[model samples]
Target chain A: AQSVTQLDSQVPVFEEAPVELRCNYSSSVSVYLFWYVQYPNQGLQLLLKYLSGSTLVKGINGFEAEFNKSQTSFHLRKPSVHISDTAEYFCAVTPRGTQGGSEKLVFGKGTKLTVNP
Target chain B: NAGVTQTPKFRVLKTGQSMTLLCAQDMNHEYMYWYRQDPGMGLRLIHYSVGEGTTAKGEVPDGYNVSRLKKQNFLLGLESAAPSQTSVYFCASSYTGMGPETQYFGPGTRLLVL
Candidate 1:
């Protein structure tokens, strides 16, 4: 089984300030990592994903994440945040190989990001 | 495309009552999933279907049942509602069950059990 841990439960930042949300995972096998954002009363949307290749993967809204294998971390970072960036963010992981023709993603408890004006 | 959609944006049920939540996707996805979101718990998978007529239990599936009669539709049913079952339910679909395919999600349904 795979599990994800989001180090922070909540993060607050002033507008135009840089921010980073930490995430770590534990799995017996190789895994894929992802970051998702959800606005109030809305469903989650993919912010970025790390399947393979470059350790630094960029996504929409000027957000990027670095996949650190030795550290077992996939931390999301944004150089500058806006008020609109305030939302709950989730980190998820799924095992690399397909087992029993089924795939499931295990998510972290979530980190609520508040970009204050 | 509508992507993924779930019916009954909000619902209320009493303890011991029964109800079903419907999920529909027009993206021609082969894998569908049901999940529940609780405060401070993020989201937990309830059930999932890799293809039509094939439903599988997920991390938290004890109080729920699922059906996938059609490729584009998945239904989650609660035979007997409990106060612990009150939470936001989300449905998601992906093109395939292999690799790192992206999953598209619906708006979600908020269920309240009293």
Candidate 2:
């Protein structure tokens, strides 16, 4: 089984300030990582994903995440945040190499990001 | 495309009552999932279907049942509702069961059990 841990439960940042949300995972086999954002009363939206290749992957809304295999981390970062960026973010992971069966994603508790003015 | 959609945007049920949530997708996805969201919990998988007529239990499947009679529709039923079952429900669909496939989600249904 795979599991994800988000170090922070809530993060608050001023508008135009940089922010980072930490995430770590545990899996016996190789895995794929993803970041999803959800606004109030809305469903989740894919922010970015890390399947393979470059350690650093970029996503929409000027957000990026770095996959650190050794550290078992996939932290999401943004150089600058806006009020519109305030939302709950989730980190998820699913193991790779699972053939002929459905692979489910294990998600972290979530980190609520509040971009204040 | 409409992507994924869920019926009954909001519902209220009493303990011991029964209700079903419907999910529909137009993306021709082969994999569909049901999940519940709580205050602190990001989301927990309740049940899933890899294809039509194939439903499987997920991380949290107890107290819930699912059916996938059609490729584009998935149904989640709560035989007996409980106070603990009150939460936001989300449905997602992906093109395949591959690890890298992106899952598209529906607007979500808020259920309140009193």
Candidate 3:
């Protein structure tokens, strides 16, 4: 089984300010990481994913995340944030496997990002 | 492409009432999932279907049931609604479980159980 932990329950930042949301995961085997964003009353949309390759992965809305293997972390960051960026962010993970025909994700407790004007 | 869509964007049900949420995907995905989202608690999988006619319980599936009669459709049923079940429900689908497959989500359905 895999688990995701988002250290921050909420993060507030001024407009155009940089922000980072911390996420860590625990899994005995290899895993894939992802970041999803959900606006109020909407479903979650993919921000980015770390399947393999470069540690730093860029995403839409000028957001990026770094996958740190040793630390078991996949932290999301945005150099500059806007009011539109205020939403609930979730981190998820799926184990690397072939036994199961499909994979189910384990999500974190979520981090609410509030971009103040 | 319609991607993923869920019916009844918003619904209200009294305790002990029964209802079903429908999900459909046009992406020809082989895997579909139903999840509930609560404050501070990210989405938790309630049930998932790997393929048509096959459903599996997920992390939280106590009072809920699911069916996948067709490959592109999945339905989540609440036999008896409870106040605790008043949350946003989302549907997601993925092409495969193999690796690097991203799950596409629906607009979500908000159910208020009183």
Per-candidate Cα lDDT values, in order, are 0.93, 0.94, 0.92
| TM-scores for every candidate against the unseen true structure | 0.97, 0.97, 0.95
The interface root mean square deviation of candidate 1 comes to: 2.0
Q: Which candidate, 2 or 3, would have the higher DockQ against the true structure?
A: 2
* lDDT at residue A112 of model 3 (Cα atoms): 94
lDDT of each residue in A1-117, candidate 1, tens digit only: 888999999999999999999999998889999999998888999999999999999999999999999999999999999999999999999888754123568889999999999
Give per-residue lDDT, candidate 3, residue A54: 100
Query: How many clashes (backbone atoms < 3 Å, residues ≥3 apart in a chain or on different chains) does model 2 have?
Result: 0
The digit string of per-residue lDDT tens for model 3 on A23-78 reads: 99998888889999988777889999988899999999999999999999999999
TM-scores of chain A in all candidate models: 0.96, 0.96, 0.96
TM-score: the better of candidates 1 and 3: 1
Q: Write one digit per residue (lDDT tens) for candidate 1, span B31-94.
A: 9999999999989989999999999999899999999999999999999999999999999999
Residue B67, candidate 1: Cα error in Å is 0.9
Instruction: Record all residue pairs in model 3 with backbone atoms less than 3 Å apart, i.e. clashing.
Output: none
Choose the strongest candidate by DockQ: 2
TM-score of 3: 0.95
Candidate 2 on B1-114: residue-level lDDT in tens?
999999999999999999999999999999999999999888999999999999999889999999999999999999999999999999999999988888899999999999
